[model samples]
Target: MNRNRAKWLTLMTLVLLTLTMSAQNKQKFKVVLDPGHGGKDTGTNHLKNVEKDIVLAVALEVGKILNKESDIEVFYTRSKDVFVPVKERSVMANEAKGNVFVSIHCNGVASSSPSGTETYVMGLSKNKSNLEVAKQENSVILMEDDYKTQYAGFNPSAPESIIGLMLIQEDYVQQSIDLASRVQDGFTYDLKRKNRGVKQGPFWVLHGAFMPSILIELGFVSNKEEGAYLSSSKGQKELAKSIAQGIISYKNAYYNNGIAHTETNVNEPQANTKSAVKGVTFKIQIAASSRVLALKPQNFKGLSNVTMEKGKKINKYFYSETSDYTEAKQRLAEAKAKGHSSSFIVAYKNGKQIPLEEALK
Candidate 1:
């Protein structure tokens, strides 16, 4: 009887341990890191500096830093110097159910004068420089087989062609912008790199990922000084560390705001009354466009209380604002019912953008 009793207790302990392990796994934050350009693509090249080699090295280093955290899981689109289609990169991130997708690359142009790091979230922009960058990156699709059919006949040279794909990522635009801003802040303050500031552009990879996504232009490789620095191990390590820290900071801030590290928490309403704090204002972001539209009911599905904020590159239209978190959610639902399917709640305080999670607190 004593031996049988001992065996029963051991069995129960083992079962409990298994359950605990499963729960911890579910809490892990999944990140999909994509190193831009590889194999035959080679990306942009200047003298001895190759875009593929530099981005791959930095991406791997960033992955190493994130892997040390027990609660963070990193997935790589490609660890080796192999070509990967831009479309396939996002498909991989979606399949892994990543919480965020970050694609790393280097910028280049005929003139070597431009040098700075810029991060992009998917959106339309009329700025000539922004459109040029988008054109250069989107041109990669032309290399793929039957690109026309795959991309619905998207003309990479024509930045306007990407408008059709805009709605797919509209729901997560604010989150993408939030993550991009953190990355830009890290590059600017920590490394003291040229602060290109966060901007919007239509990139195919950013559009395909279901979660928040950003494409990073590490720096202009065409510039001789920046090119050599990007090629150095020290520069790569520093940049990687900065990128890793930004991701960590974003994860902690959102996680504390009731946004879990798990993939299941995405695409759902972020506002909750339980976490709402005083002085927080919530607004429904209905649409963002390059065209300036009058705040007329006719232009917005006949919805009233419409307002607009013009940014550096785009104009954002909002439905209404309120201090009550629950009421803000009701407005979000109303906007969606009015054909603004991608509308989401954005929070603000003192005219500055704060995380929906932060505002909720």
Candidate 2:
């Protein structure tokens, strides 16, 4: 009887300690690194340099740096020269409950004049250049068996096919944009590379990822000088270090219980004449651009109540405001009718933008 009681007490004590430890420890941030293209699918073959080999080397180097950080847990879709389906890559990230998914690739073009890095988040883009990039990347889906069945109605060559298929990632759009902006800053400022800026495009690899995801086009492999640098050991090391720094910065800002930092406009006046309102507000986001425009109705297609919010790298213009959700939807239609075709309704709690669904709830 004494022996049995002692055994039961020991088991209960271990269980209590496990529960306490689990409660005290926070979950580690998991990042999924995917190196694009491999095996028979040599991404872009420029003379002796191959895109697959370059990206793989960079991705491994990034993993090496991130692995030393105690707060982050890193996973690779493919650490070797093997091909993994795009859908499978996202699935692996999802299965791991990753916080972010980063797909790395090298850009190629017929002309070697364009030499810059661009990071992409999943969304339908109207820009012809953005569509072309999406098309080039989406064509990889064709290499998979039963891709037509797998992707359903998605046509790699048709930009219209991706219009209504981005609902799954809408909730994560802001988060993905935040990370992309950081990565672009690292490329431009830290590595002294030309920044092509963050863009939105229909990347199939990013669509299925449940968390914040981005596809990075490192640089143009067709440009001879850039290609030589990209294929070299020193360049790869620098690129990897820059990328790792960006990821670390983002993690510190987002997952360390810190507030998202915004840049302050130095020239703007700090005087507040109006009293702060205390309810949820909705606005129609008409445009987001790197350039700041004059805040006049004539500048934004006769939209009278145009307001601009400056972010770290871009300025967003919101047209009209309403406290009602239905009225906000109507305002979105109005903005779209006035040539702001990409306009959407955004919700704000107090002053900060909150998720539309959460605000509605």
Candidate 3:
């Protein structure tokens, strides 16, 4: 009997250990890092500094920094000088179950005078410059072996082709914009680099990512000074540090209830919550799904006061409602703490959902 008891105790201890390990693994956040353009696609070679090489160095450094974090699992699309198709890069991220996707690239222009760091979230845009950037990046598909079949008649040069592309990423637009804004802040405030601000553009690389994604234009490689700085060892380290900090800041805000533990300088501005709608009412949007889910708290991690609204192609679920903006922000925090990482405060006017900026104004 004594021997049997001892054996049972040992088995229970092993089971507990295994359970703990499994829980910790479940908590790990995966980040997919794509070092844009490689091999035959050198990407914007200018004044002896290649966009592909600079971005690869920066991406590797970012991965190194993120790897130091215990909860972050970093996956690189191509660690070495190897070409990866845009769609395949997204496929790798999806297979890895990445929480976020970041594609690193250097921008180039004809004049060589423009120099700044801009991040882009996938969207259809009418802006001439944004479209041009998208066109240039999307044009890389032509280099693929079976480009025609791979892209399915999508022409990079045609604006109409972009319109025909599926907008599956629209649900994550706000989250992507939030991260892009943080990255821009890191570049402008911490690194003292020019900030071109976050913008939306239809980039094929960002199109297929299921999670929040952004394409970072590190700096204009066409500019002589910027190109040299981007190519330098010191610049690469600093840029990597800034981008890493931004990622950490975003992770802290969304995943950890805004508790920051990283040492890098990251100053994320408070999300504007002021509303113009009189008798202002707010809600916390917890999830956006392609399929409509039943309005039950159990369906949303035991989140109470759940509501759903049907959109053209997707449905959005919101949790908690309040008249006070401060209370609404608190509710948003609670939703995030409950594993709704992308939850954001939404304002309503006369029972109709309105844009946050419009409500604010």
Candidate 4:
């Protein structure tokens, strides 16, 4: 116990010193923007308009704006329409040491009446409708031939999908969710578009990211009105700019004290070192709930990480996931700095991932 305590203390000290050093050094922030579905992989084709083309235009425009305004370096998964695999997107961002990733897509639905803008982060969708959206976006992985192996075994029917999902950098989930919400909310409030609120679901493309990430569904192409708007270059530009502003908001919140980069202090004994197993203690409470089911992504996307369970028999909302409150505070701040809205607390019980509430007091 003494040795472990000493180790954790060393880690904490290192983290403090590193934070000071990072504040002193102004590293160029890096972001990865993925324009979803390219090449033969045309996404959401409707009314002679394609989701791929629309997102590409928006991404390029957003990149241009970001380059002009900030010293932050941004990279695209693909510069033009080409077959880039889903998992490769996160790999590219991580390899580049990207602080944040934004995926752009235009939504589609069988019903033309469904028109709205929504954004997404990685997690299992409790909503069947959200599951379907995830299915549409994730289906792209099948095109890659070895997606199952490449993406670390994304089995659709497994009860273990939750554990697998949590394995994708438990650190970044909160921030990603928040950033997605901000973008979706900003678009609806500023652009006066339909608000298809934020919902969680697993996407193969989002896994393996070391930083906060989000997938933006610009609008539904199946909806004639939305398809036309998304098809317009002006509309795409507007959408992209709004999303960029949301990222900027997340950055400002995180970097308020002048810290940068995602690396935890290696000098610290416990900082970034893997946590060990034990039952967790959760003083969980529902914090917020929508009076109406959030169909608008912006409405719900800005919400930080907490479990959302709306199973068949019950619907309980407004709960906090607190595996470790102290560490959660620090990580949450770090996440915001990395362009996420919030951060999450990932508790390890016996060296295995477990929900905070499941842990014993």
Candidate that would win on lDDT:
1
How much RMSD separates candidate 1 from the native structure?
Answer: 5.4
| Superposed Cα deviation of residue 229, candidate 3 (Å) | 0.9
Segments in model 2 whose C-alpha atoms lie over 4 Å from true places: 1-19, 22-26, 257-306, 310-361
| CA RMSD (A), model 4 | 13.1
Cα lDDT listed for each candidate: 0.83, 0.80, 0.81, 0.67
lDDT of 2: 0.80
TM-score, per-candidate, Cα-based: 0.78, 0.71, 0.72, 0.66
Instruction: Give the per-residue lDDT digits (tens) of candidate 3, residues 204-227.
Output: 999989988999999988999999
86 in model 4: Cα distance from truth in Å? 0.9
* Candidate 2 residue 50 C-alpha distance from true site, Å: 1.1
Ordered from best to worst lDDT, the candidate numbers read 1, 3, 2, 4
Each model's Cα RMSD: 5.4, 9.8, 9.2, 13.1
Worst 10 residues of 2 by lDDT: 260-269
In model 2, the Cα lDDT at residue 142 comes to: 86
Cα lDDT, model 2, residue 267? 16
Per-residue alpha-carbon lDDT of candidate 2 for residues 37-124, written as tens digits (9 for 90 to 100): 8877778877567999999999999999998987788999999999888789999999988988999999999897989999988877
Q: Write the per-residue lDDT of candidate 4 for residues 1-361, one digit (tens) a residue.
A: 9999999999999999999887656565677999999998997888888988899999998888777654467899998979898878888998988878888888887778888887777765556676677778877876778877875776644434533565464456656765776788789899999887776666767767888888888888888888999999789888988988887766654442234423221112245533432355322222222223443324444444435435232222322444555554464454445444333333345544443323322
